[model samples]
Each structure stands twice: as C-alpha cells, then as structure tokens.
Target: MGVSVFSLKGKLALITGGGTGIGLGIAKTMIEAGAKVVITGRRETVLQEAVDTLGKNAHYRVNDITEKETLPAMVEDIENSIGPIDILVNNAGTHHKATAQETSDKDFERILQTNVMSVFALTRECARYMLQRKKGSVIMIGSMAGLFGIDKIVAYGTSKTALTGLVNALVTEYSKSNVRVNAIAPGWITSNMFLNAIANDPQRKQQITNRIAMDHFGQTEDIGHAAVFLSSEAAKYITGVVLPVDGGATVNF
Candidate 1:
C-alpha cells in the first residue's frame, strides 16, 4: 500500500550457494534494496570474492550446508556473532546431468543431500530463532525442471518438485506467525555456467530458446529481482506459492 512495500531496508538476508551464479545475483539485488546480505558457500575463496564484489554489507560464510553436524552450531554462531537471521535463502543445491536409469544410487543420494536435506536442516534450525523474533522469511530456490517431464536430470527434477511441497506445508503452519516461507522456480538462466553450456552447443541452445515463449533464456538478475520482492513487504500476502520466473517457458511449452 506504500513505497516501502518493496523496500528491504534494514533487513538481513542470508543466501546459501550465494557465492556465484543465481545466488550471488540475488544477494546483490537485496543489497541494492538496502538489506544486509550474507552470501555463503563451501569454498572460502569464492565466498570471500563474492563478499568483496557485493561490498561491505555483504558477508561470507564458508560452512557447507550439507554437513549436518555443523549446520546447527553454525546457525547459532551466525545468529549470535553476525545477527538474527531475518531471512534465509536456501539456494545451495547440486545438479546431476544423467538419465533416470543411468543415475547411480550415490548420485541420487548426493543430490538429495545437498538440494533437499540441507534445506530442511537449515530451515528447521533457523525457524527456531525466527519463531522467537516472530519475523523472517525463507526462500527455497527451485527449478522449472519440476514443472514438467524434463529429460536427463531425474535427480535434479525430483528435488525441486519436493521443494514445492516443503513450501506449501511450511507456509500453512507458519502463516499465522512471524515466519513466511515461499519458493521460486526459475527456468534456463543465462549465468556464466549456463551460458557456457548453451554456447558450446548450437542446436541445444536454439532448441531451448525456441521452446520458450520469450525466445530467450532469463538472466540471473531476473531471479535475483524476484528474490528481493519475496523477501520484502511487497510479498506480505504471498506465501506457499511457487512463482515461476521462467520467461514464459512453462506457458509456451
């Protein structure tokens, strides 16, 4: 109802896997909206570089979310040493490019551990703190792969599909309180990693673009912009919904 709806001033946002790609982009967008952002990853170097690029308000956490033994302690540490975690972006995930039949048990387990389990662990721990504050947001980065029967990425697709379920259940229980939860399903984004993959093969790129209604892939910033909105008051009424920022890919296809 006011200009402050989309403003994230004075908020603290933590983004996992935020040292690069879509995560980094979202961190930058939130900072621009006046939110203090912490971009985290397993690698110290990458996290540090991301912090540097994101300016002083940007911080880095080197803890691996998949390491269950450390997540609880790390969350507590950040809460006390850093600040109350007002927002959590469970963006850390792993992608496996393999056919359903060809994918190994280990591969499946690894994907689940990173993409799903880690999110569950971090959210559960962080929710305790948010419950006390009665104000926070949790954003799970999902994928368009879950929208349909995508090929050659069974593990990745399944995890994203599960994320929707997570959002729905969590929102139903938390909407009446301080914590709000939601998810974003992004389509083929033109990040450095993705652009290289698309550029390496001509037909694959064209086929993908042709299938999308916009005739193009989305930029990482597009997803970032979406994240900022969801974390801000602009999305106060929005929860438990999976917003697809897929460049009309879902509709056309």
Candidate 2:
C-alpha cells in the first residue's frame, strides 16, 4: 500500500473568515484529512468558539483582512509560530444584495475592498513564501453570482468574478514555481440563516429549487471536500481552474 494522494498529513492550512459557515466547514474537513488549520476572523469570540469546535488541531487568529498593511507580518508570524503555510483558502467576503441602481459607489467599493483587494494582498504574501519553497496551494472561495448573472447582487458578483481572473493570472505566474492556484464556485449552500429565510417563503424556495438542476441546495462539506481535493497531492497537476461545487445550479435552465 502507498500513501493516499488525497491525504493532507503534515500540511498546514490557513483559512480566512473561518469562524463559521463554509469556512468552518473547510477547516473541519481539512483537519479530519490530517491538516493543522489556523482560522482567522474579525471577532475573537467567534474564532475562539470555532477553534474549540475544531478541537486540538485547530487554532485561531483575530485579524481584519481589510487591513492590508498587516498581512505580510501576519503571514510571517503564522509561519514562524505554527509552520509554513502549505495551503491558503481565501474564504472571507462581503455580500451586497441590491440592484445596481440602489448600490452606491461606496457599497461597491467596500465589497471590492474585502472580497478582491484583501484576498489578493494576502495571497501575494503567502505566495511569496510558497514560491520561494516551490510548494503551495491556494484556493479562492467564489460564488454562483460570479459565474452567472443574478438579480440584486451586482457588487458581490463583480468581486467574485474578479477572483476568477485573479486565479487565472496568479496560476500563470505561480504554476511554474510549483504553487497551484484555483477557485471554488459554490452555489446555494445551505445554512441556518438561509434555511430560515426560505422556510417562510415557499415561492422563493421553489424558484431557487427550480433553478437548480439537482433541485436542492449544497452543503458546506460539499465545498470542504472540493477544497480538500484541490489542496491535496491528487490535484498536483491541476491549476488555474474555477471548479464549481454547486449541485448543478450553475447549469440549470
């Protein structure tokens, strides 16, 4: 028997916005797959709770990603204190649900600041080390809104769409250095808040369901599994791809 290609044993992963939801899902799954994970968020309490839930292999850091000036030092500190960051998951983002006409320039710029600029800044910081060592994997958390048009989320869609281009451009530069970059476009992942929102709105639920070819929303672990694959040895040759983890939602009529 040989080593499992999918095994993340000895890997250290850094995930942003990991206090809850899909980020936490990815962290849990990665830990189960044998990686030590550090989760970052703006709230200390939330991060602490998430780490407690994640158990011994998990850690937490409270930092605002929008503070771009701190990212380089933050990355260095993490690497020195924990270990070299073998994987980076750009999972932190802000969503704006408003028509383009209703979304002000400030609203749009805020979305970009969190979703695009910060992501690139952090990725650049981590990639510098990865490129030097010639080993690393970077995963961007994208959305269905980025892949296609959706009403009332122009700003979010733009940010995510930017990630696609970022992944492409970064892969071109980093693949040669053995550092892989990719994006995961998740569609309608179920959460308590989302479930609650739809529970009282059957028509909206049905409309959403009808748009999905699978007629259902996805689970957070669905995204975690995809992240695991993309970060594992199994995907060594894969790069510059935005893999959709949607339940056929992106392709439905």
Candidate 3:
C-alpha cells in the first residue's frame, strides 16, 4: 500500500489514564499516526511529563475518572477547549484482586465506580457530541479478565465484562449516526504493573508465557497499534465487536 490505511491525520483523540503504561502507549502511537492526542489522568505531574515526552502534538489534562459527577464537565471542557473529540479511548480503569466472598462493599463500589460507572458516564457524554457531529469512534480498553473469568478478580472482572455489553449496546444505538463503538481485550501487557510482580519468579513468568501462543510478554506498543487500527478508517465497517490483542492467551489455554 502507498500509505497505511491507519492514517489519523486531522483527527483528535482523547485517551484516559494516559500518563503511563498502555494509555501512554496509545497516545504515542496516535500522535505518530498524525492525530492530535489529549490525555487525562489524576496526576498532573505525570500527565505533564507524558505530554513533555510525547512532544508538541500531545496535550494533557488532570481529571479523576472515579469522580462520577465531575466527568460531564470534564468531557465538556475537552470538547470546548481542546476541540471536538473525534476519537475517545476509555482506557482508564482500576483492578482489585479479591475473591467474591472476601470482596468488601467499599472495594466493590470503588471498582464499579472507576471501571464501569465512569466509563459509561464518559461514553454517554462523548456519544452526545459525536451524535451531533455524526462521526466518532469510542474504543473501550477491555481486559482478558472479562473475556474469561480469572480468580481473585471478582470485582474487576465483573466491570470488564460489563464493558463488552456497553460496546454492543452503543454500537447498535450509534452505528445509525455513524458513530462506531468497539472494545479491545488485551492480554497481559508488559507494564510496571506486570513487570514488578514477575521480576524474580522465572517459573511464574514461564507459567504466564505458556498460556499464550506468542510465548512472550505483550508490550504496550502492541496495544497501541491495535487501538490505532480499530480507531482508524481501516476498521470503518467494524463495530459492536470485541477484538482480542491477547496473543492467543484466551484460546491457547
């Protein structure tokens, strides 16, 4: 091909939890693909650091997705101040490892509020703007926990599973308006989150790798590339679908 179908020139994308890890990876890739990227997180310092490192095309905002009531105004501010968001990546999510019996109400609510409630709130507000403009892509950062139940992640897994429903519902509702909604279920991505835990135990690492056909830790860039492809014109006809960037972990095991 003369140029990749993944060109995102002139597009504006908003990524949540973009100060680090997979969120930052997505922001970086989108910027390289010629999109103006705005990233938001609870830490201003970290977000700024990401913006500084990501160069002039990247912008940063400080906002906590856990604050459900504040999401509307935050989304509004981005739309008005940063320009219309042609793409929204709901990448902000938190996970707590606990069995259903051991999970407390406070912990359960926290997970639901951060992972499910905020995503819906942000998606709703962004969908409104996209509906008016009649063009947009809302990409959800789903997890393998949702695709297949994982132990000790009762609350987190529940929220991620809910994300799939959100994608399907919105896809049906907004496809008529030319707004496409999709989700990506990433396998274990190599991040500070995973690296620190697996630093010493080669056996644990091997156990993890054996589950995946790829036989390696999937990097943040892998997720970034997947997000770009799904958000770009390359996947114009794709919607209501959950694409796995999991390296066959879900299937191989």
Instruction: Report the alpha-carbon TM-score of model 2 versus the true structure.
Output: 0.96
Report the lDDT of model 1 for residue 163: 91
Sorted by lDDT, highest first, which candidate order results?
2, 3, 1
Q: List clash counts for every candidate, in order.
A: 1, 0, 0
Q: Each candidate's root-mean-square deviation in Å?
A: 1.4, 1.6, 1.6
lDDT of 1 by residue, 185-228 (tens): 99899787667656667987777888789867788889999999
Q: Which ten residues in a row have the lowest lDDT in candidate 2?
A: 191-200
TM-score of candidate 1 against the unseen true structure: 0.96
Local accuracy of candidate 3 as per-residue lDDT tens digits, 112-181: 9999889999999888899999999999999988998777789999999999998888877999999999
Report the candidate with higher lDDT, 1 versus 2: 2
Candidate 1 minimal-lDDT segment of 10 residues:
192-201
Could you say which candidate leads in lDDT? 2
Better lDDT candidate (1, 3): 3
User: What lDDT does model 3 reach?
Assistant: 0.89
Q: Give the clashing pairs for model 1.
A: 134-178
Ranking 2 against 3 by lDDT, winner: 2
Report, for every candidate in turn, its global Cα lDDT versus the true structure. Answer: 0.87, 0.92, 0.89
What would the TM-scores of all predictions be? 0.96, 0.96, 0.95
